[model samples]
Target: MVKNVGAVGDFDSAHETALLTATGRNQLLDAMHWIAEGRRLNGEVDGPTLLGALVAAADAGVAGAEPALRTAVRAALRSTLDTSADLVMTDGIVPPSRYEAALANVARRTASGTLVDITGSVVMAAQADDPLVIEALGLVAGLSWRDLQARAYARGTSLPGEADGSWSPSQVFAAFSVVDDVVCGRVEPQVPGAVAARPIELLLGGTASGWAAAEAMREGGVSYGTLLAQRDVGSAWSAHRNRSNNEISRLMVRRVLNALDEAGVGYWSTEGDAAVAKAVLGQRAGASGKPPGQLSIVTRAATGGPGYAVLIAIARDGGTARKTAATLLQLPKRFNVPSVLVLFGTGWADRGESDDLVRAFGGRLYTEHTLEQLAEAASTVGTS
Candidate 1:
């Protein structure tokens, strides 16, 4: 049963016009072929369009329409390659943002299974040997309904009729893995969720529990997961600018957690700055989550050994780092525990004209250290 692509959504004269006017003739013909498939098979899904059903069937690994879909997708890929500015918008050769949005609209109009089907063609196109196809697919990689919502939430809004789904932190991680692999030609393209496990491990430090937390964070629509791979202060702040204070703290906490994982330090108890600041500085601490400006991880020198802790302050800019240093100086008397203050940034407070900030604050600073360096640091706990 061939499914007509037009049956799934409320298409109007304008949409048809947009699809026809913005797409090249051959591309338009290829798109129409999916509709034609339904007519040829005399098997219409009754409600949705042929393309919608085809997408569903393909994702389900239904053997009937696989060959036709592959052909149609190849044509779509070629249509994407035309580089002509005159084709119909429906052909997906327009601006990358609009192209992704168009695909998202198609996804939203279909059932869950069908949505995965639609993604297959995009994945197939991405897997092609041609550079243009790869570029186009990369731009449109966030089109899955789930990714669309995540992006929308990032921009501080929800799409119409959107609902939360199961993929989280894994979705962004999955998207990252897909794009990374495709760009590097390291692995054959696969389903976003079905990619191999190594990328996640490599990105998240190979901790099973940490991966679970990341999945939950992603599922709750938090922005922390994708931020994991960002390795510098500038990059971290750029991606984190518009997030909430708690989220900002969470992000900072995750970095510390990753660092601790690398350093082989395990925490006895952990609390974000938001919670700890109130306890350390009182309720007037407000939402700033200041002083530490991140979580304080309590640790021991060894099993059943003396207690120690690490306080982290992430300085995206110098002023923040200076104030954080001032705030951290006061914590020793209040907590009365041996602790280390870790400053994360590039040149935020490396020096002040003549004096070094690390000396004044009694803290360790990091501008660049690969993951292995951190892990080595972790292995030598209490040595220095």
Candidate 2:
């Protein structure tokens, strides 16, 4: 059992002694907890001293301090550490190996939501060749494109280059660029366990099977749009296609949103009647009419490449096809979009009716038996 170590002395010197002494797991945890208690008592911890001690503990293979270490890291990052002085300093108190281990332990912990704001600091402070750098790259890969770009842009001021083991300004910026490329799908993750997480993967119930299917389709060169379309394409086109457009349509709408998200496509769902009235026709389709599922999306050309604007409609077999078609056709004029896609669930244009509908809507009509198929088709058409 360890006795109360008393007040930490000479911030810099005590840091090194504690680091060397806290080699065992229990000792490391105790040291970390002590630091936490110190912070509680002292109102704040000396950033360099705390980080140096924690990093040394991590280098000793002490796993128990991971959570507390992450918290300290978050607090450290949130502090107004200088991009040059505080953030990049690795000379006196922290050696390269210890710094690397400390960073690695922090990155190993998954951070989401508001805690994610610490990303920019971590990136700015990271040294090249650190394994934690790889973990940092992985974390950014899961962020939205806009967020990724913002991160890259935030590192405007460059840190001075190091002569020895630390990362230089150019090296740090280059790492950010690589991470951005990976998120954009222009470059793939080369490191193990560095896979990017799509928004759909965050779903607890549907994640496993959905991710597996998505992976299979991705390997097959299937765009998320195409995959969604194919899923909605019912095995048989008869009664399956004609099913009522109630909860199923709502469900299909959800699936479409998810598929687009998985593909990193940007979209906004709009109430069919209102969107059409405001953007297309001069008047609402009908006040009492059941609104269809409508969305405005920018579908990716290549995986993570440029996005193309498209107006999409999810219509039922009822009398909604013509109204849907009319609304869709006018969208290009209003939104200046080049493509409009209409997904139908049963009872759309019949055999004799096909020619007229085809001529009117420019043949972008696709029949879907299920919402999954519609989603696949949307992806296919959008990508194509």
Candidate 3:
């Protein structure tokens, strides 16, 4: 204690000579005093030795700061901690200790392995859920952490302050969210669709319910066709019913318009596709026809994912039209557009062209792991 060591002297002794009360807390105070006092030249007794002691205390997840520990931490992290940039750690590389671990912590994402690498551009994550992180990881982490995500930086871009790369509570949660956007045909593999997982969230009424609806379709047994037959696609947007592209997101442009016309949601004089049609639905059904029960509405769900088998896409007479649709699907997904909405109203296409859309993606759906297993696929994608 300071008093025991005579730092506070006998001032308290005069009041109570027998006092030995302040030992423990006062000793801690002494450590703090020496730490703040700096080197011996600052009108204090201790030098770097005292300061080092204090930092050691704190570095142990303890109570004070010590110069030795501070220097070691800085030594290890000086390259990564600048305020101007992110010391991004990817591919499950754990961050190095101390100064390197600035701000918050991160966990490996469920969709992490699903990522792809593009050539260029730089973007900072605005928040943990911010889409920018997805853009960065999906495009940037080509080789190593030191590789600079520089490819992300080349085309005149910089990381933003809000980018926070965090994940859901469990594998099930993470898988479920991506599934709704991916498998249940809600979100597809467009440049924009792949940019962030939240576009599907924006559609389907932005309700947790609609999101759950999307998830239900992927859990392996539920059939979206059957559900559509039993229920209805609400005013809220719906997914592709199977995968990202049916060449259908754009086609939905017309179908949605027809629905609007029938509902008397009011009519517009303009003869062109409305602005709302410009957006894509997060989901898609590789097949264009109605499910067994639902007549007019298109169905996108999980079973269609496993129903995927390699089949020949017999080309149709509407070759150019199908080609245009495929090209159209490429755009929004490439740019990370939310809905792509490619195949929205494309029912009149030559039957052979429809088969191509189904074949290409269906072959991919298996590798995509859209459904867990055939037995569970129907129940998960089939039931309510």
Model 2 lDDT tens row, 1-384: 111122222234344454435332245456566544434424233333344445444444455444444545434322221111111112233344554454444343425312132344455554443534533343324442234435445655332232233555565565456454544445445688874443322221232333233233223343565435433542322222333334344454555567667655554443255455333321222212333235434444444532334344443343555555555444433333333344534334332233333333332333332223324434543343
Q: What is the lDDT of residue 50 in candidate 3?
A: 24
Candidate closest to the true structure, highest lDDT? 2
Query: Per-residue lDDT tens digits of candidate 3, residues 1-384?
Result: 121111111223221211112111234544343334432223221111222232334434443433323432222112211111222222333233321122111111222211121111111222233333332332111112122223224423433322233432332232223323332345444586354333222233233343243333323333465446334423112221222233333332333434434433322211243232112121222322221111112222333422111111111124534654464333222221111121312221333333233222221111111112211222223234
Which is the winner by lDDT between candidate 1 and candidate 2? 2
Clashes of 1: 19
Worst 10 residues of 3 by lDDT: 363-372
Q: Model 2 misses residue 166 by how many Å? A: 70
Q: Using TM-score as the measure, which candidate wins?
A: 1
* lDDT tens digits by residue: candidate 1, 137-234: 33333233444455446645543332222233434344434544432335543577665333332334333232233233323433455445433322
Off by over 4 Å in 1: 1-240, 269-295, 305-307, 347-356, 360-363, 367-384
The TM-score between candidate 3 and the true structure equals 0.15
Query: All candidates: CA RMSD in angstroms?
Result: 34.0, 34.2, 33.9
